[model samples]
Target: MTVEYWRAKIWGLLHDPVLKALHNNSGRGKNSFYKQLEVMKPWVETGKTPDQSGGKVLENILLADYIASASDRSAIGSVTASINYAPGKNREKGLEITHLLSGARQEWKINSHDELIKGKRKDYLVQKEQKELLAKVPKELQDPSIKDDIKKIKQLYWWLWRCLPQATCDLFKDNSLMLMPAETRIPDASIWSHVSMTSALAGALAGYDLTAAQIQRWQGNDELSHPYLAVFSFSPVQELIKSSRKMRDFWAGSWLLHYLSAKVCWQLANQY
Candidate 1:
C-alpha cells in the first residue's frame, strides 16, 4: 500500500502457497518462491491478462488477489497469511504484507499458518463420502454421462472439505454419498455451517453478489466456539440439540461439503 511496502512487493521473496510447495527449503537461494514472485511482478500488479498461465496457481492467484485486495478486509475480517517474503524463525517479514494490506504501521495482524491446511497433507478430503461419489456406478448418478461435470464437482468438493479440520469427515460422510435423502442422511446445519463460512470467505474474496439475508442468516452462530456459523447453516444443529455429537454434526458436515463443492467450483469457473 505504501512505498516501503511496495519495496517488499518488488524485492521481497515470494510467499504464496503454491510457490512454497514448489520451492521447498532444500536450500534454493535466489531461485526461491520469492524469486518467482519477483518475476511475476507484472502479473501480480496488473493481474493475468488474456495470455498467461492457468491451472491451480492461477486459481490461487485469483484467490490471493481477492484476499489481498483492499476491498475485501471487512468481509473476510482482519486476515493473516502463513506466507512471508522473508525467511527466518521470527524475522516477521510476512507481517509486512499484513501491514501493507492494512495500510497501517503495526495495525494489521498477520500470523503464519505454520501449522494450517496450506502445506499440510490433506486427508479429510479423501473420506468414504467422496470415494463413494467417485466410485458410484453409472446407474448411481442421475446422469453418469456428464463426465466433466461430475469430475469437476467431485474435485471441488474434495478441496473444500479438506480445507476444514479432520472431524469434518466424521460429521458428513453419509450425506456426501448422494444416495441419501435430504433430511435423514443429508448433512445438517452443524456440518453445513463451516462450509457456509468457508463459502462466505471464498465468495467475499471472489466478489460474489452475496445478499444481506444470507449474511444475517449466518450471524446467529454463537452456539459453538465461534459465531462464524452466522454466515452458514450451523443454526439448525443447535436448534436440534442431541446428546450424540456424531448424529448432530452429520447434516452440517454434509451441507458444508455439498454447498462448498457447488460454490467453490462455480465461483472459479464463472469468475469474470
Candidate 2:
C-alpha cells in the first residue's frame, strides 16, 4: 500500500473511537446535563462525598453546568481548558492552568463597565439556573452541603462564561480554537490532571502548533476539530478513553506521534 493510504488507515484507527463517542452524545440527548446529574443523584442521596468519588461527580457537575450555561445551542464548544508549562526549559515552574476570573477585563478586550454589567447578568443567570438545576436533584439528595456545592458550581460556570469575551464567542462561532488561562483549583491526581496532562502531551507531540500537515489533514477529514460545525459535539472522557489505543490523543491533538507513543506508555503502565 502507498504511504498516503497507510497514513489514512492509521488516521482512521486513531480517530474512530473519538468519532463514535462524539457522534453518540449531545447536550440534549441521553448524556444531557440533567441526565448525568440524575445518574449521580443516587450516590449523593446515599451520602457519598465528592472525595469518595475522587471528585468525579463534582467534575461531572462542573461539566454539566458548563454545557447548560455556556455551550450555546450545542453540547460542544471551543471551551479549551488545559495546562501550560514551559517546554524543555523552566519545566520546574510546574504546569500552570489559567486563573482568569478575578483579573481585569482589558485582556479580554471587554470594557470594565460592560464587564461589571455582564457579571451581574451572569450572576442572575447563575442564580436562576442553579435553582432550576438543583430542583432537579432528588429531594433525598438535597442536603445542605450538596446544595451549597451545586451553588458553587453555578458560580464557577458563570465565572467561566463571563471571562470569555465576545471575540472568543465569535471565534468559536467560526469554529476556531481559543486558549483560555489555566484554573488553579484543579487538584493532584484529579480528572483535571489527566485532562491537563493529556492536552500538554498532545501539544508537545504537535510541537504546540496546529498548522502541521497531519493536524490540518485530520481537521479536514474529521469535523470535530472545529466546534462550529453541526456534526461536532462533546464526548465523555469515559467514552473517549474506552478500549482504544489512540483515540484520546487523536481527539485531543488530531494526528500526532504522541497518539501512538501515549498508547505505548499506557499499555506499559497498565501491564504492572
Candidate 3:
C-alpha cells in the first residue's frame, strides 16, 4: 500500500481468476480439509526467453545436462524455462515479491540443507551435497562440459530468481522477520505451523522501514494461514524452533501482509 509500484502486483494477484477458483473451493475434501495453495493469475511477460529466465528447478538437473552436452544452444531451444529479474526501484512489486519469496526459499533451502541436504554447513556441506546430487543426476550430466560445473547451474538458478523484485528479495537478510508457533493436521499431512510465517514481513522490509502495527491481525483459516503447534522430527526443524525473532511487531505485520499478497500472486500465477 505504501508503494505505488506494487499496485499492479497487488491488484493482479488479488483479482486473478485462478485465485477466484481457489477462494471458491477453500474446503472441499474429507475432514472438510482446505486448500492452502493460492493460485496466481499470470500475465505473461514478453521479450524474455525461458532460458533467460529461471531454469526449471524440478527439472534443472536433466535440463542442464542436456544443455551442456548439446553441440550448440539449439539442443536447449525448446526446453521450458522462465527468466527471473532482480527487483529494485524500477520494479517495486518484483522487489517486494522477490524479497519475501526468496527469503522464504532461503529458509526452506537452509532448513532442507541442514535437515536433508547438509545441515547448515554451507561451504562444507554444499560440496558434499553436490557430489551426492551428481550421482542422482542423469547420464547427460556426465558430460565433461557439465560435470562438476555447479557454478553454471547456480548462475542460471539465480538468473531465474532475477525475475523477482529485489526489494522483497532482501528480506531474507533483513531484521523484520516473523516468529510464531503453529501446528497442522490433515490426511497424510500432519505438521506444525511455521515460525514467524508470512511473506508480508519480507515484503514490508523490502518496501520501507515498516513497523509492527502496519499489518492487520491474522485470521487463520486452513486456507491462508495454519493453526497448530505440533513439531516434527525433521533434523533442522528443532533448530528453527530455537530460532528467535529479532523483531516481534515487524514479524506480525510482515507475515500477515505477505500471506494475503501471496494468496493473490499464487492465484494469478496459476491462471496462466
Candidate 4:
C-alpha cells in the first residue's frame, strides 16, 4: 500500500466508532491501534520510509504494537459484553451511546468524528450516515502517484485532538461531564489525555534511537526493559470544595477544578 493509503486508512480507523469498538475490546489492542498510527508519522508526513529496503517501516510498526501491548496490563481483565457480538450485529438493532452533548441516550452511528461534531441532530441517524469512511481506502491504495497532502493530514490530527473536544463541550449541558472518554476500558481518562500521552510516548521513543534490529529482537519479550515512560499528574480538588456552602457551590468548585486542569493541559500541549 502507498503512504497515502496508510494515512487514509489510519484516519478512517480512528474515526470509525464501530471499528474502534471491535478492535479495542482488550486494552493492549486499543493501545496498539493508536500506537501504530503514531508510529506511521514519518510515512504519513513524507510519503517515504526510513530506507530503500522498506523493511524498517514494517519493523517500526511491529515495535509500536509490541510496546503498546507490553506496557499496559491493567485492562487484561476488563473485557465487556460487546466483544462477543459480531460486526454490524448491534448496528442492525441500531447502536446506542450516551450523547456527548445532552447526555441523553440515543441510537446513532459515528462514521467520522469530525462530521459527527459538525452535523445536526438528524445527521446522527444510522441510516442517514450509512457511508463507511474506510470506503476511500481502496481508491487511495490504487493511486500510488497521489501527492502527499501533509496539511490535510495534520488538520485531521488537529481536529481529532482539538476541535472535537471543544465542540463536544460547547454542546454539553453538564460541565461535570464535558470531556469524552479515551476508551470505554478507561472511562476516567479523557480522549485528550490519551492522545497527548501517546504523542509524548512517541517522542520519547524517537529520542531513544533504537535500531530496527534491536526492536525486532526485543519484540514479544515480557520484560519492561524498553525506554517507555509513563507520566501521571494529580490535582487535589478537596481543598477547592472544602468551603462549599451549597450544592451549587460544590458544582461550581468542580467546574473550576476542571477548567483549571484543562488550562494546564493546554499549556503543556502548547509547549511542545
Query: Model 1, 81: alpha-carbon shift in Å?
Result: 15
Per-residue lDDT over 1-272 for candidate 1, one digit per residue giving the tens place of the 0 to 100 score: 12212212222112222122112233211221222222234343543311233423233223433333223223422443323223345433322222213344321122322322244222222332234323332332224332234343343333334542232323443222221111111112122332233334443332323222222232343221111222333345544544337864767766666777678667864773
RMSD of 2: 22.1
Q: Write the per-residue lDDT of candidate 4 for residues 115-230, one digit (tens) a residue.
A: 43344423342222123222222343323333345454454445444554444333332233234444444334444444444443433333333443433344454233234443
Candidate 1: stretches off by over 4 Å: 1-51, 54-64, 72-147, 151-155, 158-272
Q: What stretches of model 2 exceed 4 Å from their correct place? A: 1-36, 51-106, 109-116, 119-178, 184-260, 263-272
C-alpha lDDT of all candidate models, in order: 0.30, 0.29, 0.24, 0.39
TM-score of 1: 0.21
Against the hidden reference, what TM-scores do the models get?
0.21, 0.24, 0.16, 0.41
Best by lDDT: 4
Q: Write the per-residue lDDT of candidate 2 for residues 23-101, one digit (tens) a residue.
A: 1122111111221233234333544322233332222222322332222222324544432222223323333333234
> Quick one: best TM-score, which candidate?
4
Clashes of 4: 0
When sorted by lDDT, best at the front, the candidate numbers are: 4, 1, 2, 3
